[model samples]
Every structure is written in structure tokens, then in C-alpha cells.
Target: MFYNREIYKILPEKAEEFCDFFEQYIMPVQIKNGSKLVGKWLTESRDEVMVIWEYPSIEEYRKIIERVSNDQIGRKHQEQLKKNQPYLIKTEQFLTKRDKPERSNQNITVSGYIVNDVGEMLLVRTYWRSDTWELPGGGVEDGETLDHALCREIFEETGIIVKLFGITGVYSNGETIAIIFRGKRTGGELRTSEETKEVGFFPVDPVNLSTYVKRGKFIPRVLDAMNGQYIPYEAFQVRPYKLVKRYDGEI
Candidate 1:
């Protein structure tokens, strides 16, 4: 997607008049000329307004500009804008190219740590990997939120309904990004799904964990949850074939 961001700085007293002009005349004309209005926002101080217009691509944006230039309705709107020039102070615009949608090579997983009243943690042993026990979770489906995916996966694997508390930890191993959440059992009986060979809550201790959990990181994660230690969310920016930047949120 391509975006044209227009920033209008106006006199504080004329803010309402400018917004009225935009809604009554400018917006309709722009929409009719193939411009998609993404949104319009007012800054906290109310002295500035920002309008985001979207187009499929730079080519489409150029076409819209050309069409609007010759459009009769657009010309009329421009004339009206001149008549209300006192309400407008200054305007600035810039074009931005949005990242294209593409198939991702990275894998995202959402897992839950559901502790019962007795402090036992939920564990699952999959039929395909019966030698190692792990948290009841799975890959996130397309268009599914992290919380929804965690709830669905936990219920599917262990037949337990849980209320998520918050994020416990986020771990990335180059290719896979795993988001672990803390939760408590709300209701439901312990029943194994077709993919799971066993589902039950076990004592939340490192000794008991080492005997059942296969992943080495699971022990420390469990200990962290017991100690109430949490890592904040982190966002990353990646180029098509390269890593670009990573931003970590305050804990």
C-alpha cells in the first residue's frame, strides 16, 4: 500500500471550521476521485489535523492525482477552499510506501502456562512426540489473535478452559518466535485430544519438570513464572531477506 499523509496546521480557533470543510466538501470529492481515506486524526493540542490517504500503489496514487486535477467536483472544492483560506494556515504532505504482503518464513507459536489452585502446571504429551512433555499449545492460525490462539490450543490439547493473566516470556530462536502467557484454570475436565497422548497437571518444580519436560528452557521459564518475573513485548523490523531492527518495550 502507498499512503499520502497530509498535515494541516491551522489557527486553534479555526480547527472546527477546517474539519467541517474537510467533511462537507473535501472528503467526498477525494473519495469520488479514487482516493481511499484511511483516517483523519487531531493532535492532542487540537491545533493540527492529520489525514492519511491510502492507495494500492504509487501508480494508483499518481492516477488519482491526475484524475482529481481534471475533475469538475475537485475543481469546485479547490475554489471553495480558496474562499475559506483564512481557516487554513499551512499544509504539508509526504508519500510513504508500505511493506508488501508476502509469505513469511518465520514461525509464530503461542503457549500457555496454566497453574491450578494447588500450584500444579498443565502439561501435555503429544502422540507424535510422546517421549517429551511440553506445554499445551500450537502454531497461531492466520487472522487469529495471540490470546485466542492460546485459548484454542490449550482447550484442544488438554480440554481445560483458562483465563490468561498476561505475557510471561517471549523467546525467539532465529526462525521461531514463541510467546508464552500465564493463565489459571477456570473450568473443564482433563481429557486428552487426538494429538495428545496424555494431559494432566504436575507439581511445578524443577526436579519434577526435568523428568517430564524435554525442552531445557522450560525449566527456567517455569521457575521465572513461579518467581513472578516477566519480559515485556518486543517488536522487530525485518527486511525481505535480512534483519533490520528490534525494539523492546519497557518491563
Candidate 2:
């Protein structure tokens, strides 16, 4: 287990604003990424605030931090901090470890890289991610298989039914695990859904990938799918169990 003892010194007049900012921009994201708040305290003068966070492991702590910094909401949080710097005087942190603590549930997501015979990859632009085109996908519904979830998401977002090649890559960032699959469109017309603003196929040019995908974390997933390298992935049952299926060798 690891703990983060975070101390924030702020102007007494800015205390309310700081607390609001923390609650609105920071606390939810941290909790969503598997960090737990042990407690929060305010000093006698009310100029200093103390927060303790518990994590199952140091590695998990690092992943939560990294994910918060890379994701869209995290980016917004950073900008808010810079924009509201006057509320903070100084920040201090302490990291220490002991026995591992209980961990929160992790969110699982699936995405697909659907390429056409002509070499262009299917991509979508959402309202939140309008800056760069990204693969179409979403959170896995409870009890759904990864491959099935990906197929359903693709159809919902881009109206495309796909012939999956296999698992192209897997990624983990503390609280979330994303499985990326490689495939090509088998049928269905291109149409935008409520979650997507635009949907179409675009050329996958390595030299110009950055122009299409500006998000650092998303670029590698696209690149891996483009290269055609695959990881053998399978899902199985445990209890009154069975071998559900596998997504491999099709690439």
C-alpha cells in the first residue's frame, strides 16, 4: 500500500475557491482512477489544507497520476490550475508505503481500428475530442465480452459492421484497461451517432499520424494496429464455466 500526504497552502480568502476547484476538477477524477481519500483536514487558521490518499501499490499510484495527466479531463484540470494559480501558495507531497490496501474496481474499455481495402482507417471525432480523430469505441458493458463490446460500439458510433482481425494491442492506466483490435469494415453505411460528430475513413500515413492524432496516448494504439502485429487474447468462464472465445490469429 502507498499513501500520499498532500498539503496545500492557500490564501485564507481563496480557501473556498480552492476547495471548490479541488472538488470540481480533482477529487472525482482521482477517485475515478482508483485513488481513495483517507481524510481531509484544515488547519486552525484555515490557510492550510491536508489530504491523505491511499493506493493499493506505488505502481498503481503512478498509473493513476499518469492517467489523470494524459486524459481529457486531466488536461482541463491542468489548465484550470494555471488559470487559478492565485488560490495556491505552495504544495507539498509525501509518498510512503506499507501493506497493500483494498483496490477499487477498474473500468474496462474497447476500441477498434477498422481499415478499408484501400488502406484508410475508420476514425471518429467526438465533441469532447474534436482536436484529433480517434478510433471509435466505448466502455464495455457489464458481462459483455471484449470483442462483442467492440463490435457493438463500432456499430453504434459509425454504423459499421466489421470483420475483426484480432487483438492489436492492450493498454492499462491504473483504473482503466483498454483493448484495441484490428479489423476492416465488412458492411453498413457511414452515419454519425449521438456520441460521434463525424465518422469516416482516412489514410494512415505514419509521417502524418500526428496531424490526425494529437493525443499522445492514442497515437501508439493506432500505430500498433497499423503495423498488423497482434496479441493472442481469449476470454474464459470460471464457475459453471466454459471457454467463451478468443480473438487471435485472424490478423
Candidate 3:
């Protein structure tokens, strides 16, 4: 895990000067404290500049802040700044560990309701099960965050990187926790994932509805998430209790 921060400013010319100071002074401090300089950029408008940095240890960020507060160069930079507010921001102390990342215990399954502007849901006929249309999403990985994984999955499954809005509902089926995040169509050529045979968006059509529900199971809860005004829950079972079957048949 890493601690990251962004500093935004309005002056483009000052951005170069700031980057110079950061590279010459701040970056050395960061390297000494075991941190990496991620990115530093000035926008095309020449009015906005942004800087990002990451630290393997949150303690490193704290130490940098402490050193910045006491350093003569830091004080001089502060006095030289024309902006009234902070052109340089400080983190209010945060901790992170790779073995157990922040929000590692947050029970979440990365899933999304792929919907178009007309409220139609995007469904994929997956090769994994058969001819059926289901919303694109899957289980979150152990080392990945829910939001990031969901976005990647949606792109991989539907060939579209939809902008995920806010959390619509949290669904749990006792076995798995599903985080239903809202989404809108961005821009991407439609394609199918390895699990999906056919992928496209369709309205609430009943003719194709039969294919979605197999073995008397309704999967429309994914759509309920996009309709808005759906009830939010921390945990929910989309299906009833079931027992697993073991086969002793010949291999």
C-alpha cells in the first residue's frame, strides 16, 4: 500500500519553478525517506499545475511534513508563494501497509450496472453458462480495490470503460458480497470477454428476459440498482440457501 497526495495550482509558469524546487529539494527528501515521486504536470492552459507523490510508508509522509515545517528552504518557499491558501498541501497523517491494505477488511465485490442514457441495461451472453444476458461485473481481487477492479472488469467484459458513479446498493448472497456501482456509457468499441459470447445493451424487453433467468433464478436485481431509488443494504442474499453436491463418478 502507498500514501498519495496531489497539489493543484493555477500558475503555469510557477509550475516549472515549483517542479524545479520539488525535483531539486523535495524529491531528494522523498528519496531519503523511501518514497517515490509519481508525477508532476502543468496543464496546457498554462494556468493549472498538478503534482503527485507516493510513499511506501505513511510515516514517511508525516516525517516529510515535519521536516518541511522546520526546514529553512520550506519556510522560504512558503514566504515566496503568492497564493493566499496553500499551494503546497500536507497529509493529516495516514498509515498504510502492503500486507493489509487500507479498507482490506471492507467486504466488497466489484460489480456494476452497465446502463445506457435511455435506462437500458447492458447485458452479456456469457459462454461460461450458456445463452443468457447478465450485467458485466465480477469478484474483486484480493490485492485490488473494489472501484478500480470494477472499472477494469467492466471494460474487459463489455469493451467499454463506463464512468462509475456512486454506490447504488450492496448485495450479499451469504456466499458473496456484491457492490452494485452505478455507471454510464463512456466511449469504447463493443467487444466480448472470454466469458461472454455476445455483448450489447438492451431495453427492459421481456422477449429476451427468459434467457437471463435460468433454473428459476431472477437476476434483475442488477437492473434494480440502475433504476435509482433502490433500497440500500450492507448485506443481502440474492438467492436462497443451497447445498453443494459432490460427484464420485469416473474421471
Cα RMSDs of all predictions?
18.1, 8.6, 17.5
TM, every model: 0.51, 0.58, 0.45
- Clashes (N, CA, C under 3 Å) per candidate: 0, 1, 2
Best TM-score goes to which candidate? Answer: 2
Compare the candidates by lDDT and give the number of the best one: 2
After superposition, candidate 2 runs with Cα above 4 Å error: 1-103
Residues 1-251, candidate 1: write the lDDT tens digits.
56788887778888888889888777876775556788999887888999999765566577678767676767887888787677675565766643556544466888888889998989888654567888888767656667778889899778899987667778887656888877789999999865576899988586567788877866666665566555544333346554332212212
Q: Write the per-residue lDDT of candidate 2 for residues 1-251, one digit (tens) a residue.
A: 46788888888887887888889887877765556788888888889989898875566688778867875767898898887677675465767643456544576789998988797899999755678899999777546888888999999889999988688888998777889999889899999875577999998788999988889999999888888888887888888788888777574
Off by over 4 Å in 1: 1-100, 231-251
| Angstrom error at residue 76, model 2 | 21
| Ten-residue region with minimum lDDT total, candidate 3 | 242-251
Clashes of 1: 0
Question: Which segments of candidate 3 are over 4 A away from where they belong?
Answer: 1-108, 205-220, 230-251
lDDT for model 2? 0.81
- Candidate 3: how large is its RMSD? 17.5
